[model samples]
Target: MARVVVEVMLKPEILDPQGQAIGRKLPQMGFEGVAAVRQGKRFEIELAGPADEAAVERVRELAGTLLANPVIEDFEVHVAE
Candidate 1:
């Protein structure tokens, strides 16, 4: 079996409203030294086959096509044997 880990994050230039909202509330919750915060998504997928370069490429294509928005977000895929 193979395990794939995917991390999705907004582009650096993109505005993260959700993160901003949480950052705003942190001060009121007495959490100091929180200068900035950004929200992101992580996905783990398990495949019933060996981890290979072709499988990794297919996973990357899938992420680019359906999992993340290429314009505003980026994704990284890690495959483990």
Candidate 2:
């Protein structure tokens, strides 16, 4: 079986309001010294076949088509045996 990991994040130029809000509240909540914080999405997928080129292609397609918005977000894919 193969394992695929995907990560999706907003573009750097885009503002991450959720992350900024959390970061601001952390210090107020006494979680002091939190320099910076950012949020993103992580996904883990299991493939029926071995970790091969086809599996890699499938993961790439999934990420590009459904997992991420190409206009505002970027994604990375990783495959493991």
Candidate 3:
């Protein structure tokens, strides 16, 4: 079996309320030196076969269409080590 990772993040132009809330609270919680915070989603997929180029392409397509909003978000897919 192989593992594939899909990471989805909002576009730089988009507003991230959840990430902003976390950034604001971090300082209050004693976390310092934080420049910024952006929230995103990660999906780990288990494949029945090897993590080859074909698998990566398939997962990338899935990420673009189903796992992320192409209008507001971008995604990357990779094979896990």
Candidate 4:
């Protein structure tokens, strides 16, 4: 089986409250020098066959339609090494 990765992230304009809360808490936890933080979702997909162009395209389509919200989020699909 081949592994594919689908990363979904909020758009730049969209507010990420979870990320912001983590960022604010990081400094208190002694993790410093952090400018900003944004959160996203990652999906590891196991494919039945090789991770070829066709497979990648299918994952991309899935990401666009189901994995990520096109109105407020963006997504990228890639084959895992």
TM-score winner: 3
Over the stretch 2-81, how does candidate 3's per-residue lDDT look in tens digits?
A: 99999999999999999999999998999999988999999999999999999899999999989999999988898999
Q: Candidate 1, residues 1-81: lDDT per residue as tens digits? A: 899987899999999999999999999999999999999998888877876888888889888998899999989999854
Please write out the lDDT profile of model 2 over residues 2-70, one tens digit for every residue.
788999999888899999999999988999989877789999998888868888888989899999999
The alpha-carbon lDDT assigned to residue 54 of candidate 1 equals 87
Clashing pairs in 3: none
Answer with 1 or 2, whichever has the higher lDDT.
1
User: 1-81, model 4: which lDDT tens digit per residue?
Assistant: 999999999999999999999999998999999999999999999999999999999999989999899999989888889
Instruction: Give me the displacement of residue 51 in model 3, in angstroms.
Output: 1.0
Return the TM-score for each candidate structure.
Answer: 0.91, 0.88, 0.96, 0.95
- All candidates' lDDT scores? 0.90, 0.88, 0.95, 0.95
Residue 12 displacement in candidate 1 (angstroms): 0.6
Q: Candidate 2 vs candidate 4: which has greater lDDT? A: 4
Total colliding residue pairs, candidate 1: 0
Looking at model 1, the pairs that clash are none
